[model samples]
Target chain A: MEQPEEVPHNPTEQAAICFKAFMLKNSPKSNLNLYDHLVRVLCKVMDERPENAVDVIEDLSLEVKRTGMRDKQSTLRDTPPVPAVQLLAEQQKTLFTRGSGDDVEPEEELVETPLPNLAEQSFYLEQAGVGLPREELQRIHLALKQLVDAQPLQTCRFWGKILGTQANYLVAEVDFREGEEEDEEGLQEDGADEEEKEGGAGDEDEEEATEEIDPLPVSAYKPPPAVPKEENHTGVNKFTYFVCREPGLPWVRLPPVTPAQITAARQIRRFFTGNLDAPIISYPPFPGNETNYLRALVARISAGTQVSPLGFYQFGEEEGEEEEEAARDSFEENPEFEGVPVPEMVDSMANWVHHVQHILQQGRCVWVNLAEKPEEDLEEEGDEEEGEEEPDEPEPEVGPPLLTPLSEDADIEGTPPWSCKMSSTLIPQFAIAVLRSNLWPGAYAYATGNRKFENIYIGWGMKFVGEGYTPPMPPAPQREYPSGEEITEALDPSLEEEQALQAALEERRAAEEEAEELEGEEEEEEEDDY
Target chain B: MGVTEDELKDKKALYSLNCIDWHLLPLPTPVLLAEVAAVAKGRFVGDPSFEYELTETRQQGEGDEAVKEEFTMKVTEEKRLAATVFNIEKDVSVVPRGAFIRTPHDTVQVNHSFQGLSTLEARNLGNYLHFTEPQQLKKKSILEMADLDPSIDFLDPLSEDILKGSWSLQMEGSSMCVLRSLLWLGLTFFHVPATPQHGYIYMGDGLKNLDLPFML
Candidate 1:
């Protein structure tokens, strides 16, 4: 909320200053004094008529300043000498004067006070500057409107990328064509069947011919069993492509395309053909690696020739000129066909075709034949191997010459030095080192005496090393001490100490035992006494 | 958490550079609706108008015992806030002929490093700074002055104000974390404010950290 610096400026700068002033006025801390300062500054700086600016600034300044001061006074903690009843009465009076309709009254009660009259204040300010005229404001407004309109398309492009719809245009076009066909078929077969029947023998012949032209045999054309549509379902447009079987067979029971889908398609198409310089296609993952369909599409498109009914077409005569121009330009510029030498365009088309074919082949939906190498090739190689095996018997004759020269040199040199060693001895070591370096750099570096390399390599290697060789161990269990009975036993005196303290009691117990032994004899006497 | 007017003002001052002119563009109803719904669903939660104060800190000493010196800036929302620090050393020693050297030679090895640092310290500091409650006043304020009728709600539950606010807060928080990491690096290493002699080193380091989202 720093105050914008004031300087002599142009119209754009003046407009900016005005905007800043407006923003400042809306800020929570703004007061009439600040508003007045802003208006005066704007009036001084703008090229607009000085009288109108001054009047607006002055009126706004006074009104705002008065309101702000009054607000401040009421907010002070010090209570007025007047009773609460009087205050309430005054409040009611203000409320009554302020249009106390059912809604307005309730709102006023909720707010507890009048809200700032922003519209009223702004209106008065504008009224005061009426001399400045409305044309200028209109121009500014129009400029702002234009700026606003351009943003969404840009945003759509940005978000489209984020949403991973890179081939939006191509997908949309395909969807559109599919939708139109479904709709036309739906109309023809459903309600239009009666009309066709009424049209007589010619229509019937056409229908029969259409049925015959369908590639699938009548037995294979058994429609998929229909599922009941759920209640409250948002239906799709039947005219659009809903779903198709493998090898590009259109669905028979087409659903209507939703408005949302149509919009999405349109947006995507606009994005591709409008902004993008190249033809974009979406090769969704195919089933079972059947890439032929995708490859065919790519090849057809790459030729700069339409795949007849499947390719893009101008919608009407009005668009025909544009479409023809675009097609001609594309044909001339795209080197995928016999055209201009646009290497980039050619490369892109080739890449697209390759990628499409690859995706279709590897896709989950498409089925592909592996076509493993012919068995005859393997047999021929095997025969060559057998012929080479027969030559091995003369290997000793070849080996003796190869070894004798080396042995003679070794004899003269008192055995070959380590560096001069060849074949088996050096090969194993070198292979092991190479393999070790690739697999476990740490172990390799450790053996090679490279410290820095060992540090990084060893750090990574230990993570994968087998079982017991692993360094870090899992956490150990915690032990808890016994309580209750254990604590009581620890606190209690020994039995021996107790017995020492109670010798007389032990003697009494012995005397009682002796008495008990005599009790059998005494019992006869006690029975007589009883 | 509900924000006080003062807090709101402070936030506007603190992270203004992150602000985008979304208001300048008119969006389709569906897009706007989606944005609003996201805010209402708590997918968006941030203060869009907040500005961040940029600060640069350099370690003052050599090796392990380096202390730090700091320079702070209160930048406006429009300007990009960035800092660069460099490490430079001059080598004037001459090499003598030896078995390893092979021949007499004079070599000077100068090492210079540069790093571009972002200024988001204010956001981190925001987490620590607590505001004192203002004393209740009887005076009418702008909040009281701008009261609207209860029957009328100018904005829907998923309005631009709420959505933009939420997004700004989330993005700002992430940016703050990134800035903290950069500051940590500065504090760890003994670096000097970027100069022509050490520009290369700073540039290289800066490039290494450029993938960091909030870096200028």
Candidate 2:
């Protein structure tokens, strides 16, 4: 409008040198310890002279990108490149100081051992809809009180979060003490003396190193037996596990469970990907990886869905001829058992029972390996070939025993893969029951009203099979090719004799023809010369 | 900071937690009620032709260039109970004999040469079929369906239905099986036995058991 104030004083000195190179190119490192929170957000937008000064500097940079200082600037972009004098000595410390005597108290914060009140056990396991998330039950009660103050456990617990595809696991379980079972059987006899020196180093390189470290091959796997080191503390090697991938990470442990990885994790169903060495793969294949298939799916979900309610466990007293004396009985703690009437544990899965053992479909709760010298030379070449095939082979199928009952398993669609329910159903005697399983969909268990119980699981370590994960298919293709035999007695000739007879006749005629040819040849030679 | 004294003297000891319940359980968050409905809409300014449609399309063009255009529309009541429970779950699920196959590009799948259904062919109903579409061999012919095997005969068999003993089956324990239907009251299905495992579910009340041909 009026171009004369010295031609806008060199265009306001080229707009103050383009606003000091746009505030030094959006000032991130002018030692940006948020430059006193960007000068207290430009003195609160020049003391609220706002009616939009670029919407109050875009609402104070979207309130400094919702403050965890953008997660400490995305964890300081994963750390390493610091220098400029240690980023100006970490921007001269005091980012927020106040009563900061360096808040100490973490010198091995164990406090001996008392965790379980997992927020009152997830508030009585969310009154039976079974729980978790209250910040993952306070990071699994501070990762099971730092795994019972790091080791010789004698009881640890917090075992839930499985749901893998990258990272879930959690687990824990434990037990140990009583001289830690001879130092866990001398570290499992040094992993059975390094798997018997990798199975005496050459049963053909241990069957090609178990078909290149197992995905089940070794001649369609038969092994499934060896569990008798006196049934390692009872049933699926009673309580040890560990796992981790979260809740302050480090745990791991998990070895014990073998009966050929509980018979290839009961013919593999697979899911777990919080990779503890992943490769389970599948199709009658999973012989090991994923820490022996999460210790044979936590010993087949602790011997088929853990269970408890009916007289909290008792049987123990066998103590003698152990070779599978009803799987050396075991079970224990029934201190005058009590609790089972949340309307009789919400009426029937036969009032729950299997407090862990029965495994069997040759997945062991005691199989014993039966004298192995190559299984007694394949039972003497199958007793010199089928001496009545040892009475038609059949018998391996055991299962259902330890305290048996969840109405003896089975029922998939028409219900009963342990459902139960209680925790209130209008206060059925201070209720607790629960149960759940439905073929391992996040397990559950629950009990209480005094003689407690437990189990838990938390899913995606798959099993409910049906409507999806179909898998099985590989068979049908023969479609007609076998039966064909038919060329009944034809060419009955004494061929050599017949040939000699014909040769004799031909020899005579040849001599005669030869003579006539010589005569004709001579005549022709002469005719040509002429 | 509570129940200590060794978890109140652990009676018979059971306290647990071994962690699982992965994600969906936190819930409770949604709050805003738009600042108490904008202070009760500045003290009452309701009903500007209030609405509650839920799906009834067909607009075309008008004011702000409106154009919903769902051709022949108006079918509410929750879209006729979601098209009668998706046509009775695509006419009662089923699936057995070589579970599911077709594919040589004619799409379908699951079959992996289906090694399942053996407990006496999962208790007969003529060894199941109908995972839908084959509607009575698409009205016969092809020389009266000469023993069809078009990659596990394209579905529809359930013992040539039209009401003959409406399904049933059973064996829910010695390795599952189940089946059910009875002309569709909460359907059912299952499978298991030899093992490729099977499925189907349905749960009821979307209403359909039309007196099942006067209860057979």
Candidate 3:
């Protein structure tokens, strides 16, 4: 906790020890610094392996006599020294010591005092910039205060991403279950209660009650909703499952953002790029981007569920404590699917009718597309997805896929380090089987005291919701989509072409009607003006 | 200091693209010459009532990757109509022959408002210089450098605290442009007990960051 145990008495050794302390978070030393090659290598070694840097530095100083790698002009003075060990035993101990039963890790006060803490309250209340004065600040604060009174800031915003967007159709939630560490949270709450009492706050009973309760165990972190045995209508409970990253806050999970919502989020981001300050408004009877294709495919797999319902089922065993016990007992693999199954590419093509019905059902949100009797005209809207300009000249029955996948899902992803082996082209029949598979080993949440990390177990099998993340009704694996048409109808002609023709005709009819109405209005206006 | 009126004029705040609650049909590729006229009926792109004729797709990337097309995209715009009627009236980006195909009656101006991250000041790392609020040596460092806007006040981003895990990683650009501002923009995940996923702020003038498809 204090300084290292053995502070070397010699000046050179002391300098070496101090250098190692800063080395961990510093950039590596350059090789071209030393004039001689042999001495440079020794200095490099000393610089790299800090613990025994002294001994290595000493040995190299003598050995410069044999090897010719050293520059001829360099001398013993050029060789930097090192300490005798691998790493300081005490320093190593500090790094490894578990947050000592508390959530606080080895937090050395590297800086005795923090710089002026930035104001935590919203800057909307601040009086700064070119012309505003204290009077303006006070007036604006008072006016806004009258509106909100004493209510805490209701941080309203959505965090969403399209799942199965990866080539392999794998989806990952960055901060899956970030509930505070077990008793550590409870212990902190107890400390807060004491502070409240000192401040003469009178909620002692509530504070006492909170202090008495132990923090929920880490295992108790609710996993993704398990496969829903109970049907989840998009309108009622679908958003509860959306996993998104907050604007700034990382761990807090907002309601589940639909694939359509993710697509919307992207468009919205770009829309605002030009118009930085505009209120979110509504216009079309739309669902989302071209997400229907994937959702349709998922629709087939989900046993005709209108939407690719995430709540429908769990992929494998919940990676809870009990599953770990079962994992030790079994070693066989499920060879059904090559990789895990998830809802991927759900954004490219979407089922607007199905998606909109859900949006309409969730009445009070900003993103609702109010259409007239939307459910009744569902069949009509499906045709809208097809672009109006259908090529009159028919091509072969199975032609090249229409929306040339701008690039492979992986190609688009550019193979970052976090990527695991997955597929852009999925196996449908095997996907169903994969979705039913258990949690793979490497993908479980890892939280030790204050340290928290979770990697969704990526595997060669398809992923399904375990019981924990599943909704009310646990998943009973359903039948797969009957048509073997992922590549055929989704990419190629026929479905979209036929729909496009229908849409073109419909557009013509609507245009004619609008034209006639405009003519009538213009004529009447002209007569009135005369 | 009082907020300048010009900052108010210049500061465009677009909050949500979800404003169009219903999705529009995917922007029709160059095909639909007839349909384009119909939608553009006396409006922005097709207001002149130009004869609708199918033309070959313009801007076709040559070679193996060129998309096989059913209809051509190059439409003779009756005239770009000054590109002003659609509220892109001021400081609109002009093209040396604009690429995004536009018909005179094209009513819907391609407007996107992805409220990008607030002002971030990054200096060339070689000299270990980090620009602050005022951008001058002392003033910016003294005053907490913040891109203050009332709209983003609700979403309080702790940009002033560099050590608070909200700093972006300086990575090589994704080849989005020939001329990069040489500045990387991205959102950072705060150092909380249970969270770790931050991403580059890749939304801006195409020159800033390439539109990479993957979510990091």
Candidate 4:
């Protein structure tokens, strides 16, 4: 048989394929350690390649500079730098072209001339800006080392936090035990040393006594036994577990908390009150203000998921259908369509109601008081009329209508006359809860559409009761003007009172005019004399 | 009436700002020019009592290759108002290709080259040319040229528009300081819009009406 045909081995092609495969496998882990390794390997490879290496280095340097600048601006400030691909390309080119001495020499010289300075400057700038200070860098390095070493343990805690399980408790217990043993050893040494000195024991005897009482055994002195793991105290663990591990979902790991996160959570909590289990509907907070912290929290919580508490009234087919049906029913029920422009009246009433509700929600009682004053006046007028006709004295009522009774007809406005006091008593608890929780600033389903109007009525009622008054009715439009004689007759008594007041005002005005005239005349005389 | 050279130069400058290139107008024929010359010289050209029809034509082709059409002029003399009407046998272009028009204060160029011309352009041009005289061409509108140059004196009424529109006045001589002041003004007054066309134009005053003379 002929000698086996020798196969040509293309190392460059093989390396290229291997590199591609490696990148494909590990590119997703763009974290710091892998990034550093890539950078170092690429640098080493480029150092061997002399030709086409300068361009690669320059491109890499530019990339590093760009990343350094971006890292400064990025919110995730501690993210590690990723080495430039150009650097790796340069290394590959250098490695492939290493045998060509003539091409490599000039390129090497060029790379050598500026490489150090560019690298130094880039390093200095990065360190000055985004890179941590020496102390911080040391701390980070140590922390990273610890993290790597204790990754298994940390992973357990992380999973435990997410799963709302007892993993964290078990870890805490283990740590507690180790701490107690160390403390016991320290205590025994201190106590035994003092006792031996007080007894003035010989050195050998002291040594013997020390040997007899083992320091390790002192650690066995256990305090009162810890509560059993199965025992539930205050149900805090159960609550945390429920919040962490709800059905049909994996536990989510929380990102490191920042000041912004804290503020956002607080704001969201303040608005939501009914039940923890209830879905939350969050509204975009006021723009250009710190109030967006609440919105940001809601955004974070709702991130990676579509579940939101504030999703009840999102514009959709169902909502539109309901609105249409309601409109139809309202129209059919209304009998008086002869002359009244129902739509305009309804719009105005809705607007008025909304205004009242907004004021109440804002905790502004003054506006409610203003609105109710007219109603109170009308009620008082009616009461006066009744009293005059009956000629009977009646005791004034003590307290305004209680809010609890108002809830029965809360949805309707014209059912019966009631004080705001009743409505407040009924809804105060819910309102207070809303105010305290993080949910107050955002949109809510109950606060939308006709519900807003209902809230306004409630607010108006609250103000009415608070101020102890009802709003007066508007006067009817005048059909015609009175004749001159009739007007004179109607105004006679009022005109007499007005005449007296006018005469006094006129006398005062006359005195003032005379004084002014005298002053003017005197000024003219002075001018003439001059 | 014949216009002086100075009047022509002033008109040229006004036309330049309005982007009107006047050199493109078609030259009148020798016979038509003779009639115009006779009329201008006050001689009984063709028929003083008997009416001779005058025609105007406008074409849209390039250079000397453009075509022309004829039209008739109906002239009426009244003590109340002077009126002239042109009757066209063929379509006579009402708007010239590059006639300078004025609206309120600013000049606008009439571009008949555009597929369809707005009537507003014709009305504006008529208003401006009707009101303006050759002598008044050099006199600029107080509001129009106010913010164009900053070297104007504040005390001068001619510079009132500039002064009013001036967003800043800094101590003279320092370029850096001036730049900083400008930067401050840019940050404070500039409204960076999501779209280029919708970007906010600071009108100096609080007025937001588009009809206002001010534009960025």
Candidate 5:
């Protein structure tokens, strides 16, 4: 609202101009930059029209002051957050502490897990022309004994070697003592405490500053279809694993595997270098270190290849009908299983069946979360795009049932994954029957005429893909520009369309001439007035 | 009586008995008997039985015209065990390079000067040959046999077994060399590092592993 004859002057704008001039003339050269910054900040405040402009400017000023003084005050503040190396070291300390139990009974050891006679087993293995060298076998046996005594384990079995570039990992699979769930809970609490300490150290002051204004509650990003605890004596998560570079070295227990990790591991093919902490720099990068990957792989190999003679084991009794109805179905050794003849076993692939439950596409032997979560939650989290499951949906495909014959499972290439053989052709009755997995090379199982069988794997864990193992190649780089159909001028245009284009062009030119003529006349009139 | 000197002289002829020295070259029959006795002692609870028979019953022609013929082959437990040992040895028994050689008279004899295989040669299954006769040399073309040593190559190499990777050669205790056969489960061949000390034994049941080809 300016009056016709009055000169408009905003006091604040005038004042800002005056202040800038005064500062330039009066302030020392050293402080000139700071003064100019102050002027700019004020100018920003006046130029922007925000609802809470005063409060916003006040925040901006305080932020500027804090940044200006940051260098001087940095030394006064507490040391920065704990580095990744220290955190890793702390984690490793906890792992070792957890594995090494102080008290293990000596007299009651015999009644503990019945350890396989390594020397006797080696003798048979050598006869069949499989297994590690005698010296290696002896070392492994002794080391495993030492491990059993050191850890509070119910049972321990040597789970063969996984060949690595630098060194091989001698894995020992062990089950926890009965009712050891309390110790696991304690371990989890310790982990939680450590996490709280880390969180408190890094952002305690910031949290205090905004205490009155509650922070937004952020829901953690949980990987879908979380792996359930293995409460039974079967499946991938039933046992823990400890691995070492050499037999005599200290055993490092690998972290329990997650279904997500196993699923990711299935997509990658990498050689272990016997280092647990080594990074897996791969496409769709692995979630954890080699230790976790090794655990997942061990689980996979167990589910895929661990097998026994048919009728050797029967489905274990499902305990507790109510509440635990969806419990994992397990297998137990059949007391009445009489040994099959070696000739009969060697004659066909049907005699051999996987005793371990089959691993479903979801990387677990059993899908246990069926009755727990609502159908909607399951659908949202499940990897499959299973269309809106109804409340009464049929049981999802878990996989072929436990103890399915080896012959029933075909290799990806349509060839039988297993090859059955008798130990000796000269003496059919006395010879043992052997089954070797062609799908996963280096996995072999042998059974004697009587009730005795064992499965062992010794290879650079890789699936046989017909040819030599090759790391999958990265996808080809995307083309920068999309290709389009080539346009040629050979085709003639219709007469009507051509005439329309010509008329539109002529009309546009005439309009341009008219505007130009009007502008030239206005210029002439202005010149006459001058 | 008065007789011609030439005729009378021949009448004083003498005969001398000649026997094979069992110490130098042990009689195979007795050794075979000992093996059977050991096996029979275990099977029959210290009663070395002399009777074990394998009966073969064949029915000829269709159901209506079928003539049931029963053939009873009378065999002792000893003979059966000996036959089994012979069968296993025929297929899987192996010897290191130069351990045996072909004589000019077309016979294979132990090479006394073989000083055992070198460590490098010991590692490879190709350096060991089946103790039995060489079927491969006879089948090889003249061009393929050009580089083969007739004296040493008179037997097929263990590497030439029908199923490749059936033979596993390894060093035990870094001193004693051992070769095991996957096909013949209990067949084990041991050789001292560097001496004319090598031997093979098949202690498995009397059966041939026909499934080896599939395993490989």
Candidate 6:
């Protein structure tokens, strides 16, 4: 990893330097050029910290250098190491002494949180962006041609957009309000011209020229009407574009007055505090993402603290089964002979693991809704003035409001008053991408993407998806993996041999202690004789 | 994959990234937690595209003021990953002019021209690139999946350190297509056969045509 004396002033230059180094080191004489990589690194950086472009780019290069180019090639999923990171068995208290308990982290372990992936950086960029130099803009546009190369994923915007609120937001399009200035200038100007002409011009000539009554005054090109100044202080801005091959980069992010999002974020925090017992909905591809998101809001009430009477245990399976024993028992079960189909066994096992993830510790797997448009967008279109500029024109086409979708998604109709909602597409829209980028890395670790010290043994299981009362799986069975000895026994012989050798080496240290003791005793005798 | 780590490591963990085989995914383990991450697979037709549909369904749940207040069946969801295949035009030049599309993951392509089909000719509307195409994934068998099979020794079952895989695929063969379909256009590592023995695959327009006949 190259260390920067200080972060370079020009991000593109630094990106160019790293990009060249990266290409030479990674793909010399290959098709991917320095410009291509520089753009991705730069755009991703600028999006996350628009104002801090220099810092972002420097941090990015630093990240690239420090982590090595090899690391970026893979997914951001953090593992609890090969032993499929199990939640560390916790004790009442931890010791500070060297190597005392499960709490003692190994010196070599890289317990690092992943920097946002290209996808996440792009997603955040979608909601927000930083202004860029025009030269960089040209570079991005030219790179757009190159961005179309074959890719697994590519960045794009969500269709149903929310216009804006108090926070900073990207100007997606011109927002058309209901009322117009009503051609007051044209009417007033024409009247003044008529009065002046009535005195000077003859009636016959005036009548002949009437055919050309209101030739629009060739006044200087008037910039389009201004948006209500009270809404946002920042003037109209241009969006940042990057070369795209496939997905991973977010186009931009919107900052709206999403109190529910904030409330949900708070609820998420409280869920960790053991304040909410809202059952975690499964990850994506399951059904009912609404439930997952709505429950996110109800972790507690803001007015006063009222923890849900129901905790994680309510959603769990029958009690009395130990996690380790259950895991072992399930692991040992040859489901093929046990009368279950492989797929069924797989589902059952997945469910069991899912249950173990949810019950034994805090559940991290969250349901995030991917995109689908909402009604307000259509309504807002109707509300747009007919006199407004053409729809197809890129000139200032702002989007609709934010709150409706959240309230729509979160609405409660049939349920008793105790229930919250999972109605809005917004819940899934903003949250899903962020969740995937954030928690995906730790999904497999035993702590399921949590820290050992936090004792928050949890990680995302599966995101809830689909559109039905998909019959909930028979509650998850208790789960465990083979014990340390058993898990290790299945490992390489060299590892065991290494273990034995280390044990032997530790025991051998006693000889040195014994030798020193004998020498001291002999010395004492010699002194007595003297 | 050749696209290295986004999550920068502290100087301490740099060694893990430096080592070619050490990776953070699949949570490397000795005893195969074969069940944790299994390979799943499916097939695509001759063309490089799929049909997209947005379907809606209603789910009724009893809860507080919010639960019953919202949702008329779930609004606008995908019933399947892909409902139809959007064929790209055969002409290489038309690719950037055709349509915008994406994979199940957020991987997106603008003005994507797949090998052409007449059914979609009339519908080549350039206006709609915003809604990223949702993906279609089947309950693919572990054997059918891409990276999982290459590195894993299911037959012997975790005899060695769990074999890790980067996005390594052969460039000159049809394996690229099959692999490309699976991986979309993420960064990948390829094993170069020469003395030094390392190569990489990234999404690039320059190398669009390579070994074609060998793909599955």
Per-prediction DockQ comes to: 0.01, 0.01, 0.01, 0.01, 0.01, 0.01
Per-candidate Cα RMSD to the true structure, in Å, reads 44.1, 38.3, 32.4, 35.9, 33.9, 44.8
Candidate 4 CAPRI-style tier: incorrect
Q: What Cα-based lDDT does every candidate model obtain?
A: 0.25, 0.61, 0.27, 0.26, 0.66, 0.26
lDDT of 6 at A479: 67
Best by lDDT: 5
Arranged by TM-score, best first: 5, 2, 3, 6, 4, 1
Over the stretch A304-325, how does candidate 2's per-residue lDDT look in tens digits?
A: 7877878787776564356354
Give the per-residue lDDT of model 6 (tens digit) for A1-530: 54555577898878977766666554554334555567767766766766757656767865644444565567777754532111111120121122332245544322321111223323333332212223323333322212222211123221111111111111111111223212543464567468656754564465456567775434244333211111111111111112111112222222211223323233221111111122333322221122323222222111111111111113223322554333211112122322212222222212111111111111111111111122233355485544544334233222211111111222122211121211122443222111111111111111111111000101111111211123324637646554786456564569789899767755654665566765566555544753
Q: Give a tens-digit lDDT track for model 1, residues B1-95.
A: 11332211112112222344332212124443333322221111124333434466878889889988886544221221111111111101111
* TM-score of predicted structure 4: 0.14
- Global fold similarity of model 3 (TM-score): 0.19
For model 3, what is the alpha-carbon lDDT of residue A69? 34
Query: What is candidate 1's TM-score against the reference?
Result: 0.14
Q: What is the C-alpha lDDT profile of model 5 across A303-360, one tens digit per residue? A: 8788888999877665324325453456678899998888888887788888777777
Query: lDDT of model 2 at residue B167?
Result: 65
Supply candidate 6's per-residue lDDT for A46.
Answer: 65
Lowest summed lDDT window (length 10), candidate 5 chain A: A93-102
User: Which of the two candidates, 3 or 4, achieves a greater lDDT against the reference?
Assistant: 3
lDDT by residue (tens digit), candidate 6, B24-56? 332222222221112101221112223222233
Q: What would the per-residue lDDT of candidate 2 be over residues B11-36, giving only the tens digit for each residue?
A: 12111123343222111112222222
Docking class of 3: incorrect
**Residue-level lDDT tens digits of model 1 in A481-513:** 556775565657698978775786557556766
Q: Over the stretch B40-68, how does candidate 5's per-residue lDDT look in tens digits?
A: 32121111236654456899999799999
Off-target runs (Cα >4 Å) in candidate 4 are A1-373, A378-382, A385-530, B1-159, B162-216
In angstroms, how far off is A29's CA in candidate 6? 45
Error of 2 at B143 (Å): 14
